[model samples]
Target: MQNDLFPTDAESERLRYEPFHESVEILDLYEHHRSGEMDVVMRPLGENPHATPKATMDELQSAKEAWESGERATYTISSKSDGEFVGVAEQWLEWDKRRASFGMWIREPFWGRGCSSERAGTMSYVAFEWLDLDLVSVGHDPENEQSRRAIEKYVDAYCGQHDAVLRNWLPSNDFGDPTGVHVYSILQEQWRENVTTAEIATIRVGA
Candidate 1:
């Protein structure tokens, strides 16, 4: 377990990505879901750690179904180099594009490397630029400073009040209990103002 170099494990073999470009490829992430070597995978907090279970073919199918049916977008969180699987992120919008929620997570090693922020920023960019949505939202576990710090890193990209929405709504992957979820958002007009520099930089972060 070297600190500087990425491991030679199969799960660590990832695709290549430039320093300032996005290399988000999710196929292998779904494939590498069985190895719970990373801190963040897909977990429904405040519920069963095994509630939705790990990512699988059926899970992908269900996500696809939900996307197609809901007319929303979803993607697997993949690291550029080493191709290590991280987490997943998606967007959910409501009536008239008035509001939309953004969610993302990553393995502990990849958390602060800006992948989550990258994905979150990408989600925001897409929602405002591509989908022409009205507003974008993100919810973070209160007690999870890492999650909160990640969200706050690019807080400028979003606007509106940072308030608690679902009290004990999300499953806490820790003990299988409902944990409070704090929500943040950015309006279309606000995003337009903050869209000046809306991109993430990619680098070979050590695990």
Candidate 2:
């Protein structure tokens, strides 16, 4: 439901990342999920807001289940200085396609600070290198320019077709706005070509 990061800051206080674990604070995630900024970023064209703490916790638990089931991979984005839950990144795999679709969302306070872009880079590395997946796909809503720009920052790394638009691809919300989704993808061969200069370093995920 969220998107991209800034790569200039390599310091720990600026950002650090780890795979989502049971130790992550559910409340912190709940707050991010319910914030007005997240609502707008994730649901500007839609309206299924998680209005309660219980619902937020349930959603987190469900995500954990999905991760454990090997259906997807999820990571917690945090600040090293305080280890705060600033965001999350995920790769939802489509086994049939041998592709993983990356998704991420940063806390409202962390927006514009490059958290999303960092996570995006990490997601690509893990999918293309660690997982040895065939392809990586990412997309954003047609009207979400912020998301568009964030995702576009990685264009050189993937360089797939930019004109692939799916009409009404996403379900309409109460507002019934344009649901066309723009998709970008990179083949495994392309990733291999870009890995040398992609600045990819593996983010360890423990069993």
Candidate 3:
């Protein structure tokens, strides 16, 4: 059965992470994916960090297929001021559990701009308010201090709790060794209490 709570299309115009197909240029996205810096973090997560053009296209197509199948939601992050590609945001849904896990990767040059926090706010709104999911969660590689800090800030703001580290939760390197992850989650009720109306007003979702 199709889940009516899942949005077929959604975006945050003010936050700058819109629907992937609407704003992402394949070559531009591929360029970022192939960067050495990106590879260092993403490759361990099973992403083709040094992806070729064809591979990047195939991955995008695969994500589209997943979206159509009601498996996940993915968005392209761009600069609203200039429309420059900056990153990608993802939500992996577990419908039966009413939970969604979030993930993202930003370009090196765009780091420290609070893009992660904005994406977190908008996606939380989508998961709880738009999708009516019971829980939203995110995890980070233990060694990635930048991601850990960014995730902690938004999770704290949303009144989320840090769950225990899950050992061997993700691939640690290209060789497929295991690594632990720091998990955090926010319940729908917590979001209701902490996320203000003004913050929600800044996000716009499409049907």
Candidate 4:
């Protein structure tokens, strides 16, 4: 099912992001998932802390299927400089409302390097410019101050509004139990007004 609501590929000055496909190296993804540094990221998704090689392969396959089925837009983030796997970014589409929610987890090595903001800017470009969506939303576990800070920076840059904290909105632990999430959203109009042409130029959507 090809969905016009998602972009096949996109990139920024520092990162290249695209749907899961054959070129993605499973071993690399598995190594990253199995690393102790990724425990924090995995916990929020209720993923296995001790992810086996098979588990990583299965998850990558699942993401590829989801993208093909138009159920989600999942991108593997990589460095443009050396093509190193940086992390993953995803967008959950709500076609009826012309809205999509963003989610991402970066490798610990890439943290504090503006990768999150760059990825957000590129995805927002896809949502508004390519997908023609009305709004792009993102939320993070309340206790995740790192994510909170990263999200807030781009949300503010896009002239987005901070929505309320929705209680029990996300999985917080390995148990899959729910937790509160701080939500934010950027409307198409707001994106049009705040994201400059130069900034938009930095994101190449058809990459």
Candidate 5:
């Protein structure tokens, strides 16, 4: 599920997406988890924000196992600028349907730099173009405006019917109680017509 797309020269030489390797340090995952920036992701999944390092490592080890078994693909979003682990992008695959769900979260310090947008765009290409998958979809907590805006660039249309209120879906935070989420998706043909042309141009210039 890994590819040769890392160390990209397109936007920033220091920023690239690479697959999650077993050798990756557990401290990195623990640090990101404890940063308090990931609550946007954790709160929605009802996960503990104060997870122990061992627990974090175990989770990453499981992800690595899943990748090896072709059940999932996860990438470490890195920054060469300071050699830091900025965030992650994951695609959950369903081979029978030839479809995947794409998700990503960037650290707060990296926000407003278009990092999420570009990486999400690249992975969308990886899913629909490189992997030849039929569809890629993503869901977000309705209150996560950052996620909503980041995902809007990839999907074809919104699914109002599929978007429903799941009571107590998101874990309570300082802001408020749990909230409902919305879903959006893009089909392969829609990506070819709507996004490929521009993405290919950008990748070519940078590749």
Candidate 6:
């Protein structure tokens, strides 16, 4: 019964390629390289008290480098959101050719604006068209309904489908509902008819 609702890549839809980027400011108000007044940028996907800006900045710098090159990884979320850093999103390529996985995080102040879908659509499009990739994947916990909806929109835009549900995927990880991991993905050649109508638009300060 559940299998029918959630299908594999072969039974699901794919997406056409597109280009995309998510932007953010370099600093928060205190002249710090952060994105919030509460000093919350470097925490895990869920909330935590021990987050530090110094650690996040270090990781983010490395993430930027990894993204610039066609490496085996993307970004891990290091964010605090009062619309200062605008949040983070990154994709990666692997040597195994299994599937490219993407992750996205928006500042709390700017989460509902629908940037998630737009970024995902554009990135999915790019991965399929330019990168010559096979599949794209994304995941979230069951307790995070907002994140779940965002992932749904992204996959919907890219015409992606359900992957495996990694039950109790990361019990040790701090992210809530580790047992309820939900994965979604799609392949190339499924962008016909525009299932991706993401409304979020990207704007550059100088360009």
What do the candidate models score in CA lDDT, each in turn?
0.54, 0.67, 0.79, 0.82, 0.65, 0.51
lDDT of 1: 0.54
Which candidate model has the greater lDDT, 2 or 6? 2
Q: List residue ranges in candidate 2 displaced over 4 A.
A: 1-14, 33-37, 45-48, 174-178, 196-198, 201-207
Clashes of each: 13, 6, 0, 0, 0, 6
Worst 10 residues of 5 by lDDT: 156-165
Q: Candidate 5, residues 1-207: lDDT per residue as tens digits?
A: 443423222223346666665435888777767887777656544455646888887778777777777777777777756767777778888889988887777777788777766776767667765668887777887767777776664453221123344556556755566666677767777667666455565542122
Highest TM-score: which candidate? 4
Which residue pairs does candidate 6 place in steric collision? 17-125, 18-125, 18-126, 41-79, 41-80, 168-179
**How well is each residue in 81-168 modelled by candidate 2, as lDDT tens digits?**
7877677777898878788998887766788887766676666666765677898888887878888887777755556546588988
Better of 3 and 4 by TM-score: 4
State TM-scores per candidate.
0.67, 0.80, 0.87, 0.91, 0.74, 0.63
Off by over 4 Å in 4: 1-5, 44-46, 171-173
Q: In candidate 2, which residue pairs get closer than 3 Å at backbone N, Cα or C atoms, i.e. clash?
A: 4-116, 4-117, 5-114, 5-116, 5-117, 6-114
Candidate 6 versus truth, CA RMSD in Å, comes to 10.5
Pick by lDDT: which candidate is best?
4
Report the C-alpha displacement of residue 68, candidate 1, in angstroms: 1.5
How far residue 114's Cα lies from its native spot in candidate 1, in Å, is 1.2
Q: Write the per-residue lDDT of candidate 1 for residues 87-148, one digit (tens) a residue.
A: 65666667475667876545656645666666665666556655577777888767667777
In model 1, the worst 10-residue window by lDDT is 1-10
Model 6 — TM-score against the truth? 0.63
For residues 112-167, could you state the per-residue lDDT of candidate 6 as single tens digits?
A: 77667755765565466446677788888666778788888767765668777787
- Candidate 3 or 1, higher TM-score: 3
**lDDT computed for candidate 5:** 0.65
Residues 1-207, candidate 3: write the lDDT tens digits: 334544545445445665565456688777776666676557536554755888778778877777777788888877777877777899999999999999888777788988888889888988887888999999987877888899999999988999989989775566667778999999999989999787777787766
